[model samples]
Target: MRTTDVVRAAGGCVVRVGAAGLEVLLLHRVSPDEWRLPKGRVRPGEEPETAALREVREEAGVLAEILCPLDETEHQFTDRADSQRRTKRTIYFLMRPLSSTTAPTDPDFDQAVWLSPAEALARLTFDTERHVVGVALRLLLGQD
Candidate 1:
């Protein structure tokens, strides 16, 4: 039997009402060439909610306020650098953008774009994130 290292992380489904409808922000990683929601590991002494807002600011370069917590998702993967299996538990928040301009401060992501819920669901590389977006949509639409 093996014990898996669990990494605590957080992120946001930053959304707004646009012409096409609710739009979610998605980050395009440079190296991996994948579309994902802005997220990162929670630092020492940092709250998960704080980490989620910081990640959104750092990765998307957009200031946002949390409307509500959307979901907490866990997934297992092998870390590319360490080659060790790990489980990432990420808490996601539903956020509303405060600033319109996007100038990503994180070098890991080269592009940040707002996409409709359907588009975001199709573009997101991970199912966990897509599910988070769905949760956000439900909350915004008063369906939850």
Candidate 2:
């Protein structure tokens, strides 16, 4: 696959259940009024699952383990860095936090915070992302 023309990324609904219900980790963009799950471009020769795990760590400073495959969202857009038209396919996984320590480390986002699943679902900028989070929630409830 020519990565230049088609970019691949991976991310997921990293969650923790609490008294308030399920909470998902979301990263707020530095300038844009948008919040999204941790994600980044997949490196050459890197697996999507590996990329997902790395993105969570690098972007949110959250260590998590994938519970299952959730879904994939694909969209074509122009790359801001080079103005090249490209298609990005992002695969989402249902992940659970492995530890309580977390922080936002990536410079791309201003902050990362946990939000209630309902609020998070509503705050997602894209419908596809909201759907992915729903998928993860369904999977979690099903297993309970």
Best by TM-score: 1
Alpha-carbon TM-score of each model against the true structure: 0.92, 0.92
**Predicted structure 2: lDDT:** 0.87
Spell out the clash pairs found in candidate 1: none
Model 1 TM-score relative to the real fold:
0.92
lDDT of 2 by residue, 31-132 (tens): 667788888888989999999999999988999999888998999899999998889999998899997767888877888888998889888898888988
Residue 35 in model 1: lDDT? 96
Best by lDDT: 1
On residues 1-144, what C-alpha lDDT tens digit does candidate 1 reach at each position? Answer: 234488889999999888978888999999888999999999989999999999999999999999888899999889987998898889999899999888889989999999888889999998888888888888788898
Candidate 1's C-alpha runs over 4 A off are: 1-4
Question: lDDT for every model?
Answer: 0.90, 0.87
Question: Which stretches of model 2 miss by more than 4 angstroms?
Answer: 1-4
